[model samples]
Target: MIPVLWHLGNVVVDLVLDVPALPERGGDVLATRTEHTPGGGFNVMAAAARQGLAVTYAGAHGTGPFGDRARAALHTEGIGILLAPRTSGDTGFVVCLVDADGERTFVTSPGAEASLTPADLAELRPGAGDLVYITGYGLLHDSNRAALLGLLPRLDPAVTLVTDPGPLAGDIPTEALETLLTRSDWWSCNAREAALLTGLDDPAEAARALQSRLGRGAVLVRTGPDGCLLHHGGRLVAVPGFAVDAVDLNGAGDAHTGVFMAALARGADPVAAAHRANAGAALAVTASGPATAPDAAQLDAFLN
Candidate 1:
């Protein structure tokens, strides 16, 4: 079985508060309700685990209440943890304010997730047929960024590197972005993130631009509700999304990515893998919480 080396470290507790509307500058508003769940890269990890993938999480999980919770969550999802050396700080948390429309805004607090080092990655040995998943959050942090960059060149040449630049793609330094693109075997991003990275509004064009920049990789541009675009081998294919009543859009993209990678590892073609991913993402948004991705049975039912 192919392993997915998930470079996920920022295991955060998300305090989700439902509010009528966002407050204006210097204003205040009362939240109707609040809930907590494992978040951050946990979303991606959980999603992949649900697909029955062999996933190893390579990140820091500190010794604290939040870390304990993250550890429990990972175990529950059957995800293997390759934590970085223990650090002084606790695990991180984020305050997510969701409006009536389910749009979310976040205020984050960094923690052990930012403590990744080259040494930690050196301990992880990925061989051919393995997929290494990375997020832009890791690349934005100074320490983690350096470690990730330094670890890239040392990875097995046949190991595929997949990256999701997240919302912070625009903030990554040009040199770092170039290096990441050069090393990436597959680039995944939502429409907004695609626009931020490529300055292209059209998802297809953005995928093409990213693929061109990567020179030898494929690109997947996710278009929420409308599905995703896959660009590879000088061809572009539109993988249509499933139509579902979305309750929360939080982990949909992460679910798509996780399921997509799992399908790839299972030897599915790119388009077929994307179809399965789209179904998984559709099911994800119909529920709540960041790590509420469907298991393989649920995904099979949804796809059927």
Candidate 2:
């Protein structure tokens, strides 16, 4: 059975410019490349589909060029998209500049992304055996957050919920995080997100804290370069990421989350599935864009 991934969150276009160094005010920088790719919710959906998962993405986008680009991009990856109506405001966009070390700084205009409201939840209806991946920002905002909270009771018991508290997941109130975690089978976060969420300086402790807060849900803390720690019931499992000369770290974590969810949907054990996700994510950074995620064959070869 093919894994069906339901992604709900903001959709934007990443306009990335490779500069020799960070740009200065009133100064011009030469960009090695300028490219736009589907970001946020769509990025996760596209990555999952590339790894052979069947994906459906429901999100808001303006009727501008950015929205058109997002739709075209998702369709190219075989992702089913349910686009929200266009608004008079500008489409969502993130202007990012990457330095020599592959570190990125972003300037964002939420625009249509911020317009995604509770009413938009009507688009999601997951079946048994499907994996629901909720992006963090959707649950951070009051309106959409309530919508996501209300939908928890409707989730099929056979369906697994994988929550990616994107960059802002930790910034939300603890009560909100608790509400989302209660319905999640897996809680995935990066080192920074773990620290921010649990107020624990150490990622391992943060993982434990999150696990405790979620009661029975598994806490997966992603430590870039060092690997990931999966915490459950006072026990921890370490899944190290594959070593690769990473060019761009954009969407690597999302790739990991998508692949791990896909593996879980395929009935793989958590540890093994995490290892596979590591491989897929490791392959992700070798390229520069959100769609850089590898297919099953590429991941299998990398694993071999």
Candidate 3:
């Protein structure tokens, strides 16, 4: 069977520390809780696998302690990993500190996650009717970016590309971003990312601008709490989000996109898929880390 889901991107473990207040330089603060789990592309693949898809995670990991732990973590999540060994360097990591309001500040270290090459993409080639999810971060790096772009045009028309341009800081070239978006069937982004992409403040406006740029189908703009808006199918529709007690916001968006793609792979309608995605994301933030994402049955139960 063809893989219903394919993720070619960075895989890292995130360590979260929640503090009452974000501390300043030279200030001492105690964290409320410290939680660590697999994050990024690995997290997305794990979430999708739990939703009962045939998922493959193709990326890079180091031979160091963090990489070993990260691979083990992916195994526990039931994600199939196509890992490239890193001869030297630690695996990727994020040190996130969430404040009382649930906002987080991150200090990211891209270690092994940054080492993926075009050679890695060759291992997980797609057949007809497969879906590939590409992260913007992976495409920012030179070696991997060329590899990623090379795979795009060759994608079977039966295949659909879902992209999350996560944090398009100066790393990702503008032309690469445009090319990726131009090739993708569905584009998912949060409010800030939407704004950065379209230069629009309102989420709805951002969706409109993005749709205009792409001009083929819908643009999914994820608004925190207010819900996600889709500008496509000749209309602007909103998928209402559940109000959940958010512990840590890390991986919530990725969880939403993962399950959303799973639903699409199952041939669900766009609106219905969005609802399913919304429920999945709600379940994701209830826990402190990525591994706690709900499975298909659990997400359905939550919906019921």
Candidate 4:
């Protein structure tokens, strides 16, 4: 079987509000535009599909408007949904306040996607050479974490597991984080996430420490402007990023993860894939939305 990206993470609706700046404590501030779009794990799945990887989503969703939008997006992106939607509640959403500087703050309220059952994931069966993407967001929820932990062992050992300990890496329980990291074949995250996870401010030291936590897998620590540090096997490589005027920071990391995994699945070495991923992320930040990750031709054009 060929490599397919199986995303076992949460998907949510993004209630994006563009503003000039954040409000003061207990103060109200409002401004420009608003958009409701699918985000979270959806960004990574979309990025992978855009790079020509077949993708599937096995996470729980609900039977409400947010869930409807989420499924619609998955279908539009040509991704398959393995689990049925929950009958009780709708999907979750994140209220994103994007300031003029393209930085964002989120207020998230998880809905049905926060609860996952072993039964909901029974249909998932990844074959050899498939790429499985796991996010740290699921570990934050009790039911989701239990279900995710249970599902991990069922995946074929030949399938590569890529773990991205998401934004709030500091919040994930240590045992759970270690279990996830050791089972995963590759770990990837940005500079801030690395610092938060390791409590070391320096990216290089953080990368080394995080890499040591794993059994034999590699680590990638992304430094926003300077590109990424990839430690594959035993060698550490510094891959430079393409500089662009970043208009939005959201989904840039997802773009990098998706494209990087896609490149690796398509037979590129870690360094080469990181180069492609850097270009993909650079292009992603130049756009305004969460799902703005470039497709093959677009990425090629940017690289050229």
Q: Please tell me which predicted candidate would have the highest lDDT against the true structure.
A: 4
Displacement of residue 129 (Cα, Å) in model 3 is: 1.9
lDDT, model 1, position 147: 82
Q: Which ten residues in a row have the lowest lDDT in candidate 1?
A: 1-10
lDDT of 3 by residue, 156-242 (tens): 776788888886633568888888768788988899988887778889888888887783546898897767998768789998999
TM-score of the candidate numbered 2? 0.92
Tell me the lDDT of candidate 2.
Answer: 0.80
Residue-wise lDDT of candidate 2 within 1-304, one digit each (tens)? 5658877777788888888898689889899989887787776776678777888876667888888888888888898876655667656888878878877777777766666665677646788889887777776667767777777778887788888887776567677777787878899989988888878979888888888878447989999866789996569988887789999888788888888887887788888888988888888888987657788888889899
Off by over 4 Å in 3: 169-171, 215-217
lDDT of each: 0.84, 0.80, 0.81, 0.90
Q: What lDDT score goes with residue 228 in model 3?
A: 91
Residue 256, candidate 2: C-alpha displacement in angstroms: 0.8
Model 4 misplaced stretches (Cα beyond 4 Å): none
Provide the lDDT at 124 for model 2: 65
Tell me the tens digit of each residue's lDDT in model 4 across 218-240.
99999986899988887778999
For candidate 1, the lDDT comes to 0.84
